[model samples]
Target: MKIIAAGLLLMNVAFGQTQLRSLRAVPVPEPSGLSEYVRDKASLIRLGKVFFWDMQAGSDGVTACATCHFHAGADHRPQNSLVDPNSPFRVNAELSTVLFPLYLLSDPRNRNSAMVRDSGVRVGSAGTFRRIFEGIVPGQAAELGRDALDKPEFMRGDMQVRRVTPRNTPSVFNTVYYVRNFWDGRAGRTFDGFTVTGANEAEGPGVLVARNGGLERQRVRIDKASLAAQAVGPALDHLEMSYAGRTWPMLAKKLLSLPPLALQKVAIDDSVLGPLARKEGRGLEEQHTYFAMIQSAFEPKFWESSERLNAAGELDPMGEFTQVGHNFSLFWGLALQAYQSTLNSDASPFDRFMEGDSHALTPQEQEGMRLFQNAAGCTRCHNGAEFSAAAFNENGSTRADSFERTGVRPVGDDIGSGNGAFKSIGLRNVEFTGPYFHNGGQSTLEQVVDFYRRGGDFAPITGDLRAFAATPGQTAAIVAFLKALSDDRVRYERAPFDHPELCVPVGHEEDESGELKPGDVATSAAERWRGLAAVGAGGNAAPLQTFDEMLRKFGENGERAHTMNEACTASLASLLGR
Candidate 1:
């Protein structure tokens, strides 16, 4: 009778018993022995939040982690999102206000059909300056040029016009649950204090060579901190945030001396930093320096020097100072992780529905959920409480070990992880995160549904997408379900989601050849850095809201409004007009 009941339950669920059983939010583990390293978790989170948004952390003193992830933890800017036309995954060649869906071959069913010309959308990217390098490998130091410091190359010439990322930016919200990060899963689960390459592949000693010539690596074992692992990638990434030949030590040295969030204002009532602001009664520049904050957050053993004084009583710059420089990278990584770990948006309508509030979801949304589980089979890849198989749960305390080829593009083009296998990202805030997929080929959820409806554009489709077939109404239902996943806390500035001010780059100035000139780079940097220096000089600086907040603050004019709802409506209207 028990066996029969189990079979009946499996029959009732659309995605079968296995998938239904997988859905549940797992609590993020607080880093063990964190208290030994950090004076207080809240203080560390506060410091981390400041560092995450601080433009001074970048080599150009402009880009921040928040620069690419300001809008609901994902990028929203459309300009400079275009990729090279010759790229195998290239969707479109033209730059326009609107991005169209990916072009399909003549026969919609044939995955290998020559894609239609002029049919792809512009990919989203972080607007960053360029560094000129003669012959530097990706992970090694470059031979510094004579003008490396003074006249450092700033996104000039034909090759350096728009700083577009190769892949679309994924949201950092709820990333603590992800076993690995990045679309390619290059950022591993085990952070080895330095590289994203996990324990097995990382080449460096895990120990922190101390200021007193003592080495320690086993003192802290930060497990389940993939977000910390992911935080270290973009700092030195030439395309994402750094100039050519920029080292981790260089970034560390610059930030240690400068004020945190030097380019942006901090709100007086910021949830994390409110106490600090209240005590100081001043903004970021006046209240605190990165050095002080780092010292406050970490143990003195990590930063204090034990070097013997010389005859002139001057400490060696290269000897004991190198340990402090290395400590900066460690603090940056772990602190960012500490801040981002609190970014779990688990209070969605769907969450309420799962918690026994049947009426939490509207009838349409419930129907969409039903379709997603059974007919759409979205749960095959996007399962569990975070709505992704890539996420870890308490019940299933194992690293997510699956990547799928969704047949979005040809196998030959950018064969990530051997034949187009991309990590299945969590879909919690799918509505706000536009230009979906690794390539950003689909501008709207409707297009994504259509792509699945036609069984995808590529051959050898994997997961439940192999059998996916949805009507227009069903697709709409699925989209409605996805919208229900959005949390109100994320929509509003509240608690953990509430953040300090940011001066995100909107668009870049282009030269005649469509390359970014040095003036353009300086102008972009200046725009972000404005009011930063003055804040230290007792100037009243207003906090800069994100692009989305600014858009909603001003009337939702065509130029300002870039929400998913607006984009979807425009896409539907364009389709109808066509």
Candidate 2:
């Protein structure tokens, strides 16, 4: 019976039914138990909320789970500018749009293609990026310096450092329902019947190993329990929070051991530590006080043993205790997972527009949606309620053991999309998450569309996939639909972070340049074209060529096929050129 079904699919393709095949809408589970911690118990959510923003969870007090998996609720960073450039990053632009390099340069690959040159020069996509890090003035130094590289609240005993994380952070907003975590589903695995399947799948180290540009094939079932369990990866990942050295248990104990006398005398009203510090003085001491306040803010009554503790003489007048309860760590995971479960955005206007709400979307948006679902073939992978398929495949027909290459395969020991390929990210709340793509290769929504329309990755240095091309205007409609996915209401905002007491001369100064510098030459037309080719050559060139050929197969204009050059995205060029 399975063989017969496969045969029919082939016959359908032969009969030109490939384009006519109807997409099946997979059912997404409703938000359940997610509200168990947040719906009515705002206090529990309140605790979770504070923890989400608390950078002290990491060893250095500089990083947080949120640092990479930012609440902007989308993929993190574009063009890998957020990290030290000596450590590079790359991605397939079509699968993502919001993470493009807004102020960084495309990585240069040295293959010969229609779009790139083998100059062996590594240039940033954003001219000002390097300058931002190196700093031209004092204020610039303060803004970009990595002085307080670790979290101020974390105990030094909790510090741990490892290799850079293998993949970009996925948004946590609507992750409650997801079974697997990480781009390659490397978390959530269980030891046996004791663990959830999804948890088991995501439990290993963050890196993915591909066999012949494919993942190891296997069947796995996922559930919300697994999603909740998988949420702990960052807290333990050395490159992320690196809390493994100072497990939540250790962190809790350390924070509990601090002398209340010092904490109390630290004065909620000291010049540098006062609650009103934000209004009056602005100094390093004030920031340190703020971090202390955040740690001390959790009401003592809710956490203390009250009457029992008083009888035993174990409680303080301020109702504080000397030790944190074991439940605190368990509660941390519970609250986080529960809150993430509610991150569903299925009720978007675009969803309604597709469900027969003719007025839900503007005509332009409606046309764009149509293009996304049908003409552009984007629905092949980004097809469900969350706007992506968890199932891995090679193209639409071939079953493969590895994750999708998106044709960004690198050349000559470059090790492009081998062990480094990421999972397909869901398209939700895309507008606020600038610098799109897994490795953040592209910088804008239109640029992402242009990438897909042209095909997948291009080799920037080697010019490996320079022959790939896309139809003009085909990507514009797709870009329109992606823009509609933005949810401004949920966009995360950064609260003031100050830790003056942590001002102990700060950590080691980084020698490498950072993103958003001021003196670099701006990306030009020629540079962008070379960038496109560079991206293709760096990844799976086969699909890049195949997809571009498919675009031409649909009769898109060939003469207008000038590749992106400099940093001017097609959409930007359209407006700037005019």
Candidate 3:
């Protein structure tokens, strides 16, 4: 009788029509561990929030942490969704399939991995890996120059077209629950996944060093687990936040410039840049300005205070603080995490039905759920708590794995599946995170279901599940269940943002030749120093390289430096200049 009931239930689910109802999102809780810091000490999480919202930290003040991540419901949108072309700042604001780098902060508790490089650079070699390093390689810089040279118009100092980052910025919400970060699961263990508590610590040992008669590999114990170890990578990534192209001294110099009150209040490593600049007999004040600018970029309150002055009440502040940057970073990280923490889609009608809520799911929805678990093979990888194992594998390639193909072309090196194979995502908020697939090829939910129904994304016939073989009616039922996962109440907030001031201002124009506009400044303190350093370091150093030069040297060489930095910085300056 039980077996008969189960089969009947499946049949009803498949055949019945169901009305879609909206689900309310559970309220998210605040982050903990704030009071643990010393008296009046700001928690890293708080700082992260402030930093996330502060757009001044970037070259264009208009871009904040929210700019990329957007709201939790949106899945850091613009990923294949297309952007408003009329917008001057962002020509194409698509979400990437990869993650970017993070900069280093002078927290005493943080440590980083030693730069490791193998003598040989081979593509597609098994067990081979590559790590981004601090120093700009000659080949890389030259390529950047070429790209700059090519896109003279949009690539100009004040009007850059941002490059599509290698990876998509994952939603930082609920990230705390995951043990790892990034598609490859490389960053979670070392840095407490994103908390400032571990800010001063070194990265986990996942690297191997090979030298003459000496090859030692250091493996981290944390990698054995998943959820507890994923937040560490963003702390050191160049593309995400940490210093890219610039060095510790450069970053330190920027930090030291914050107002003295700001500087003394927080305990950053003063020695990294201070002592080095002093020893070199270089004026540390410029470096100080750089740091101050970075702080000012993030924290508006820290910059506005006039505490560093004499009896006459002159506003001659001593230190520099990008206070806005720090606060927003903490804020965004925590808020996103907070929301994500509450992202329990377990209460779906389908789940309630399983828990004896007879009215939880309509007949059609129940059939959809059963089909999802059984005949549809949807539950194969999309199972468990998150509906995904967070593991990477070919969901059956569009062609070889199945007979049907959706005509979606495979991206570069789509070799079956590899370590970086896209991790299976939970379907909790699947509706909001389209266009679907790792590369985001499919634009609609029906299209996605159709892709699977077709057995694979591409053409050529083979494999057991080759013909998704589902009738049109069955496909509709499954899609209906998928649609039920959408939660509309999850709102998004657009935070205000501005640009950061660069050390040396540069010229810019919107014309095609990448030439400087009239009234545009030509030099910056950073540029001067960078030029001198380049020349002193044996490269022909020009105080300012044209946009054309920057792109060619950096863009095409596969170095993928943030090409938009110069333009964003210039744009910020223009706004401030106004």
Best-fitting candidate, scored by TM-score: 1
Compute each candidate's TM-score over C-alphas.
Answer: 0.78, 0.50, 0.46
Error of 3 at 21 (Å): 19
Q: Which stretch of 10 consecutive residues in model 2 shows the poorest summed lDDT?
A: 497-506
Candidate 1 residues lying further than 4 Å off, grouped into runs, are 1-25, 32-36, 85-98, 104-115, 118-122, 132-159, 200-221, 278-282, 285-287, 306-322, 510-555, 558-578
- The best-first sequence of candidates by TM-score reads 1, 2, 3
Tens-place lDDT digits, model 1, residues 1-578: 55654563455365532353323335775554566567757667878888787655555455678778866688766445666434333211233323456554564444455667444333657555555533222211222211233322223322234366767788889887777788877887776566765563434534343444553443335666677777878887777777666666566655655555543456666667655553332246455766778778888777665443222223454442344565566788789999998888888888777655668789989899999888877777887666777766554365355578887776665576667888877888777776678877776677677776667776767765754666667778888888888876665545666665554444454457644434333433222111211112121222223332332443334332222122111121211111
What is the lDDT, from 0 to 100, of the residue 566 in candidate 1? 28
Each prediction's whole-model lDDT (CA): 0.60, 0.36, 0.33
Q: lDDT by residue for model 3 over 1-578, one digit each (tens)?
A: 55654764565445421211112221222223422211222222223333343323322222234344433322322212222212233222223322110111132111222322211111110000011233322211110111122333123353333333333345444343333444444443232323423333456322222224332333323221232233223333333433334322222223232321110111121211222122322223334443343342333332233233322222235633222222222323333343234333444555545444567677777778777877877755455334544421122111111111222333232322332244445566564444455444444566566656655533332223333556777887887777555333221111111111122112122335534333322221111100001011111111222122232343433232222232222233333222
Predicted candidate 2 versus true structure: per-residue lDDT over 479-564, tens digit per residue: 76776665433421211111111111011112244222211123101111111111111121121111122223322233211111
The numbered model that scores best in lDDT is 1
Q: Worst lDDT window (10 residues) for model 1? A: 528-537
Clashing pairs in 1: 91-120, 131-244, 161-516
